[model samples]
Target: MQQKIAVLGPGSWGTALAKSLVENGHDVRLWSHKEEPVQEINNKHTNEAYLKGIELPKELKATSNMAEAVADVDAVLFVVPTKAIRSVAKQLVAVLETKPVIIHASKGFEQETHKRISEILEEEIPSEKRQNVVVLSGPSHAEELAVRDITTVTAACEDLEQAKYVQDLFMNDYFRIYTNTDVLGVETGAALKNIIALGSGAIHGLGFGDNAKAALMTRGLAEISRLGVAMGADPLTFIGLSGVGDLIVTCTSVHSRNWRAGDLLGKGHNLDEILENMGMIVEGVSTTKAAYELAQDLNVDMPITETIYNVIYKGQDVKEAVRQLMLREGRSE
Candidate 1:
């Protein structure tokens, strides 16, 4: 059965997902806040600014008008950045008429409030205007998925039926979707892994070998699990696709913006310069600040996260930060 889906935000990930839905035989309306991308996506069947050289599905439509994109859609998938989710949700509720299932692929906590994307949606989108809120996450990347490279992700909602519906909507020959009930774990793993990816990239930038990167990732997972479990997430979900899987891919892959940004930092570039150079959102930078605060508030022991926070925020030398981490009091693993 075909469904009318609206994908908000036309960045690399959003455009790729919209194209995938169009190929899956569904009516997809991709919304962009900027008119340039909208015109490019609709007129040229390409989003050259973001996807660069990748052609989009001809059937996919792009709009700058929020209402126009979401009108009569069976589901509205928010693919905007974490900071924009609340503002976008406010705009959505103002225009949304149908009680479509709300899904979000964006990962990160609200900077000021530390709320999840689903929580922001729940508070902004009136209950009468939507069904269960679902979070779609995993190790997948936009660049790879845009080119039809095999990818898999998790669709998590407390409501099993809603999760299965999203699974069916996105599953294809190259893209596979799994259902999980641990929304807390899925969201936590999705947001926190970017920080680790940044650290991994920094390790590479500093000319460290595989052993160093491996240690950072292994201990990074421990920190992520500690914070997540303290917040009431299922411990098992940390090892699943959104957890260990996302950590490996984002930390190791060159395609990750967070990793790339961290790599620049590791090579001795300043945070502002690295972000300006990337010309895209480096989620881990903001995530590091937010996670640091959250860990402090929750009294969770996250040495790696604390170290990265010092490098990015406290102006500590990256090499010195790594040294401090190595010198920490050792405990049995």
Candidate 2:
């Protein structure tokens, strides 16, 4: 069966997913707040600014009008940034006319509220307007997905059937989807891994070998699981795709903005300089603060997260911060 889907946000990930939907024979309309990319995607069948050199399918259309893009769609996907999600959800409910399956591919908690993405959706979108929100997340990167790389991800919702529905919508030969009922675990894992990715990139930038990164990632997963379990998430979900899988890919991939940002920081560049140069959102930078705060509130001992927070926010020297981390009291693994 064909579905009419509206993808809100024309960033690299959003554009890539929209392109995939087009190839899957769906009536896909991508909503972009900016008219420049809208015009470019509709006219040239390309989003050069985001997915450079990739030609989007002619069937994939884009619109600046949010209401028009989602007018009669079967599903509406929010692919915008974390900072913009609440605003976008507010805008969606204002124009949404039917009960559509609401989905979000964006990761990271709201820095102010420390709320997960679905929590924000639930707060903003009335239950009368939609079913439960679904989260699509994993190690998949937009750059690779745009070029049809083999990618796997998880679609999580409290309702198993809803997750299966999404799994069917996205699964293809090159793109695989798994369903999980652990929304809390999946969302937390997806957002928290970015912090570790930053740590791994800093390790790489400091000229450390693979052994150090492996240790950071391994310990980072332990920290993530600790906080996650404290917040009532399934312990086993930490080893699943949205958890360890996301951590591995983001920490090591060249396509990770968080890793790139951390690399620059490790090389002595400030956050302002790195952000200006990257021209993309490094989610981990903000997530580090949010996770750090959450950890403090939960009384969870996350040493690596604490160290990264001090280095990034307190302007502590990266090497000195690392030295302090190394000198901390050893604990049983």
Candidate 3:
């Protein structure tokens, strides 16, 4: 069934998803806060800053007005940064007249409260104006998916029916979606993997061999699983697409902002300088702080995350942090 969908973000991921939905025959209205991108998307059918060298579907519409985007839409996909969720949700509430399936694709937690993206959404959007909220996440990158790369992601919601509904809405020959009922597991995995990716890039920057990178990825999953389970996520979810799958891709791919930022850090650049150069949000930097605090509160043993936190926030040397990680007491695998 063809439906009207509003994609609430004009970043690479948001534009890629909107393009996919248009290809799937859905009427897509991509919302952007900036008028330049909105005009570029509607008039030129391109988001040059976010998705360069990629042509968007001409049928995809865009607007700066949130009311026009959410009005009469069957679903609204929130694709903004983690910090922006509350503000966007509050604006959404003012205009949303009827309930629509709320799907969020962004990953990360609220730095202040340490709440997941889904939790933030539920807290902001009233129950009467929203149906079940779903999370779409995995290893897929916007650059690859924009070019029609075969990608698989998980649609997670507590309600299986809602997950399946989202699965049907996004599934295509190039883009495949699976349904999972473990929303916490999926969301936790999605948020935490970025920290690991940061570590992975640091390993590469420090001139570490493949063995070191492999070790980082492996042990990173262990700590990620530990924190996830402590937060009520299923252990098995870590091995799924949103867990280890997302970790591997984000850590290894040059397209990942977190990995790229970490790479600059490893090459001896400061956080402020790296952020200035990257010109995008590297979620892991913020996520590292949130996960570090959460792990401490939960009494979870996340040495990797702790070390990364110190390196990023405490001004510790990256090489020194790696040495400390290696010198820690060994535990059984």
Candidate 4:
């Protein structure tokens, strides 16, 4: 069963996902906003700017024309950055036909808007097909995914059948998929975990050990669950693939752009220097600001998120932030 799929954004995650679907025998039309990435994919079957070492499937057609990208597609996979989803979704309105089932692979809440990626999509996509929205999230990283490393993830949607459809379309011997109904929980977990991963990386960069990292990861989850539950999500969803699962992988992996950014910050490099050098989107960087503001607005207690916010935006010393975190009143877990 060959399905025509449209994948927007040609960054690491977007390219990896397009490759994954293409290898599974789907006809994938991948759209890149930049002409260079599109040319590399169409002519050489590679995304030089992002997934450099991996070869993309020849069947994965690359297009700069949005209409050509979405034409006759059975499904659309959105892999753009959180901050960029709104504008991309707005543009998609012009190219789309009968609305395709939309799957979002992004993992952060919009900072100024405080809206989830799916939320932004809902506004741009028709209301009649809102339930068609599905979120694919877990511990999947683009680099390993490109090399065919075994990966597992959860697909969440309000419609069980829709979730299963996505699970069937992408799952393979190397990739296992699970389905759940808690879309909000899954998306929130994926977005919020970036905040804590940065904290763990900061501790790691400051010459900390496993104990410190563990404490941050554990307590960090408590905050994520608190916010999720408050926002009408199923509480148990936080324990699932998108929550604790993604949290662990992002916090521990050296490949996480968010954590690596924090590591440089903890080691004394400024945010401007780190961003200029990385030349990529660190979802956790802006997400920290967004989550901190969200916690305050919702009256949620997220100490770790707050302190990191101070270090990054308030220009507080990283060591002082660490000391302040330790000096806070200790309570029983």
**Tens digits of per-residue lDDT for model 4, 1-333:** 988899998889999988999889999988988888888888998887787778888888898899899888889899989888988888888767756889999999887888888888998888653348999999988999999899999999999999999999899988889999999999999999998988888898899999999999999999999988888889898899999999999999988988898888888888898988886888888888888888888999889989989988899999999999899998987
lDDT values for all models: 0.93, 0.93, 0.93, 0.89
* lDDT of model number 4: 0.89
| lDDT of each residue in 1-333, candidate 2, tens digit only | 899999999999999999988888899999988899999999999998889999999999999998999988889899999999999999999999989999999999999799999999999999999988999999999999999999999999999999998888888888999999999999999999999999998998888889989999999999999999999999999999999999999999889999988887888888898988897788888999999999999999999999999998999999998889999998788
What's the CA error at residue 42 for candidate 3, in Å? 0.9
Show where candidate 3 strays beyond 4 Å: none
Candidate 4 to truth, TM: 0.98
Name the regions of candidate 1 deviating beyond 4 angstroms.
none
Q: lDDT tens string, model 1, 1-333? A: 999999999988898888889999999999989999989888999998779899888899999999999999999999999999999999998888889999999999999799988999999998899999999999988999999999999999999999999999999999999999999999999999999999999999999989999999999999999999999999999999999999999999999999998888889988888888786788898999999999999999999999999999999999999998999987999
Displacement of residue 158 (Cα, Å) in model 1 is 0.2
User: CA shift at 46, candidate 3, in angstroms?
Assistant: 0.8
TM-score per candidate:
0.99, 0.99, 0.99, 0.98
